[model samples]
Target chain A: MAPPSEEPTDGAVSPADYRTLCDLLRERTGLSFTEAKRYYVQRRLAERVEATRMPSVRDYLNLLRFQASGAEMQLLVNLMTVNETYFFREKYQLDCLVNGMLDEVVRHRRPGERVRLWSAGCATGEEPYSIAITLLERWPRVDEFQIELYASDIDSMALDRAREGVYGERSLQALPAELVERYFRPVAPGSWRIIDELRESVDFSLVNIVDPAQVRRFTGIDVVFCRNLLIYFDDLGRRNAAAMFHEALSPGGFVALGHSESMSRMSSLFVPRRFPDAILYQKPAEGAGA
Target chain B: MGLVKAGSKGTLGTAPTGAAAPEDWTALLEHADAGHRRHAAQALGDRPDAAATLAARLPREPDPAVREALLTALVRIGSPEAAAGLAPMLASEDAGLRNGALESLQQMPVDAVEPQMDALAGSDDSDLRIFAVLLAARLGPAERSARLHQALERDPHVNVGLTAAEAVAELGDPAALPALEAFAARFPDDPCVAYTVDAARRRFRGAS
Candidate 1:
C-alpha cells in the first residue's frame, strides 16, 4: 500500500479516496453526493479516520468496505445523515393534517377503530409531536377516537431527543402562542418541556424509510408525513420509499410532502388532493359506502 | 474554479447627480465599459422594480469591481428580488463575490434570508454549500442548527465540514456530538479540529 501523504493538500481528501467513500455511501445509504458535496464527504469521513483508529482515509475505506461490523458502519451512517427539524414546522400542512386528512380518516373508520399517523423522517420528534399537538388542540375529544402516533427516523440520536421531548424556544417559534402555553411547560429559560401526555403519544423508532422490509413493518397507517425526506433520496430510494408508503397506508390514507417536494415526478400510487392552502396525496379506497 | 479580483472602490462618490431616467440607467447598465455599468447599477438602486434587471446581470458581469458595485446596489435596493439575485454570487469562485453576496444577505430582511440561502444550501457547488452553512449560522439559532447539521453530515468539502464543526459549537446541539467526535478522531493531530470538537462536546453535553 502506498504510504499516506502527510500533507494532503491541507484538508483536501485525495480524489481516489473521495470516490471510494462516495461509492460506499451510495451503496449503503442511497445518498447521492456531487462534486459540490465532495468536501463535505471528505470532512465527515475524516472524523471516522480518528474515531475508528484507522491510519488514513484509504484504511478507513477498507474497513467500511471489508472489515468493520454493522456497529461501525452504523457509526458512519450516524455521522453522515442530516437531521434538521423543529416543532410545528410548515403549519399550513399541519392545518391540513388536522382539519382535513384526519377528519377524512375519522369519518371513514369504523367505530373504535384507531387512526395511526406515521411521521417518516421525524427528526428529533418535532413532526410527530406536532401531529399530537394538532390532534389534541383541534380534536379535543382525541380520546373518543383511537389514535396511534408512530414516529421513525434513521438517526438514533434524533429519536432519543424526540423521546426526551425538550425543545428550545427556537423550536416553538412557528407554534401558536396559545398552543405553546397549553401543551408545554417551561423547563428552563427559553426551553420548554413537552408534557408527558404529548410525549407518551408518540412511538419513536429508528427505521430507515428506504428499507422495504423496515418500512413494511409500518402497516395500516392513516396518514404518513414523509415531509422534507425524499428530497435527500436519490431516484431509486425515492421511488422505493413511495412504494413502501403506498403499501403501508390503508386505502384512502394520505401522505404529505414538504412544500418543495412533489410526488408528480416519482409515483402514481397516490392522487394529489388539494386542501385550503396545501396539498396531500391520497390512496384510492376499495369499497364504496353502503 | 476561476477566481476574479479587482481593486475596491468607495461607494458612488457623490449623490446620483439626478443622472438619466430609469430607462437610460437600465440601458447604461449594459454598457461596454465597467465604470458605466457600475454607475448605472448605482443609479438604479432606488428603483425597486429595476431589481430583476440588476439580478439578471449579476451572474454574467465580467468585472469584479462592477460586480461588487452591483452587489452594493442590490443591498441598497434591498428587495426580495435583489436578495434572490445575490444567490448566484454565493457560488462564485471569487472571494470578493461570495463575501459581497454574504454581506448583503446579512443585511436583508428576515423573510428574504431563507429563499436566498435555500438554493445555495441545496446547491451542487461546494463553495455555495459552505457559504450556506456559514450564512445559516448567522441567521438564527434554529437556522444555524438546521443548516450546520446538514452541512456537517452531507457536505463533501473538508473546509465546509471543519467550518460546520466550529459553527455548531454555539448551538450546543448534542446531535452534533458524534460527528464532532468523529472529526476529532479523524484529525487527532490537528489541534484546531480537536479543540472545536472538545468545546462542542462540552457545550452539547452541558446542554443535555
Candidate 2:
C-alpha cells in the first residue's frame, strides 16, 4: 500500500476538488457523473491517493496527468471500471450467437465475403473470444472464411487485459473442459491464458458505445455481441446504441443483448427472434420493412 | 508449532530442533512467507484446527497476495469455521477480496450454510442473493424452496430470478410449478427460465 501523496490541511473536501475530478474523468473516459457519484469519486480517489503516497488531492491529480506514461493510470482505470462478467454468461444469448447466426452470415458470403463480429463494451474481452471459440468449435472451415472479431471497451485498462487474454481459474468455471483445453494454456500457477491463436483472432480497441458516428464507420458486421452492457445506460442512451447497432449491422444481421435487456420498449427497428431461453433481434431482410 | 506441523506435509524438526515449542504455531506461520503461504495453507488441507488458525490471521493481513492465500486455504479446508471467517469478507472494500470470499463461500457445502441461507436470500446485495438461490438449490429445503419461489416473483435482478427458478426446480415441489410456469410464460425467450421450468415439470411428473 502506498501512503497518501499529501495530507489535507483542512479536514473538509472542497467543491472545486470534486468538480475537477469529475471534469477530468469525463474528459478522459466520457463517464457522466450523477449527483450521487460524488461519494464514489471521493472514495475511489481516496484509495488512489493512499496507494500513490501523494501529499494532497492537487498533487494526486497531477500524478494522474503523468499516469498515462506509467502503471498508475492502468491501475486507476482497472479499479474504477466495472468488469461484471462470468463464464458462459447469458448462456442463452451465446447459444443464439453460435447456432444459426454465424452459419447464416457464412452462407450469404459472396465469393470473397467476410464474417465480422463486434463485441461492444467487451470488458476483459471474454465475450468476443467466447464468440471466436464458439465459431472455431462449431464451424469446421471457420478459419478459411475472412473472419474478424472486433472487441472494444471504454476502459483502456480493460482493453489491455482483454488483449492479454489471461484469466484465473474462477473465470473458467462455466466454460466447458474441452473448450478450455483447446483454447487456453496454463500461464500462471492457477491461471489460464488464452492461446496465441485466440488472442490474435480478436482486435481490441477503446470504443465508447455511446458514440454513433464512430460505430457507423464499422459497417457490414454480421453479429454484434453487446450482452449485459446496456443495463448501465439510461433509456435514451440504450435507444441510441440500439439504433447504432441497427445501422452498423448488414442486412439480416443479429444482435444479442443482455439476458434482461430488450429492445421491445426502445426500438421496433429490430424484429425479435426467440430461441429456447434467449431473445435476440435481427435486421429485417430485403423486401421487409419495420 | 506442533499444530502447524501436524497440518503441514513435511516432517517437523527434521534438520535441527530448536527452543520453538510445538504449541507455538506463530513460528510456523512466520516461516510460511508470502510466496509459499498458499502452498503452506494448502498443507492444512481440510483440518478444522488449521482452518481456524488461518481464519484468525486472514482479516488483518495487509498483503492482498497473503489474503488470497488464506482464502484458498479456507476453501480447501471447507469447515464451518472457514465459512464463518469468509462471510464478513463478502462485503470487503476490495473487489478482489469480495470476489474471492464469495467464490469460497459458494464452494462450501450447502448444508453447512443452511442456517444462514434465509438471511442471505433476503440480502439487498445482488451477489449474495444469487448465491443464496444456488445454495438453496443445492440444499433443497422446503422453506428455502418457497422463499426462492417468492424471490423469483419479486427479485429485482434477473439473474437472481433465474437462479431462484432453478432452485425451485431442484426442490421439485409441486406448489412451485405454477410460479415456474408463470415465469416461463413471462420471459418465454429466456433459456435459463425455460430450462428451469422444463426441469420442474419433469421432476413434478416423475413425483406424481
User: DockQ for each candidate?
Assistant: 0.01, 0.01
**Model 1 over residues A145-255: C-alpha lDDT tens digits?**
667778888777778888899999778888888889898999988999898877876777778775544664677788899888888765545655776677678788889
Give each prediction's root-mean-square deviation over alpha carbons.
Answer: 23.6, 25.6
- Top lDDT prediction, candidate number: 1
Error of 2 at A211 (Å): 2.4
CAPRI-style docking class of model 1 based on DockQ: incorrect
Candidate 2 TM-score, C-alpha based: 0.49
Model 1 chain B: ten consecutive residues of lowest lDDT: B1-10
Q: What's model 1's lDDT at B57?
A: 84
RMSD of 1: 23.6
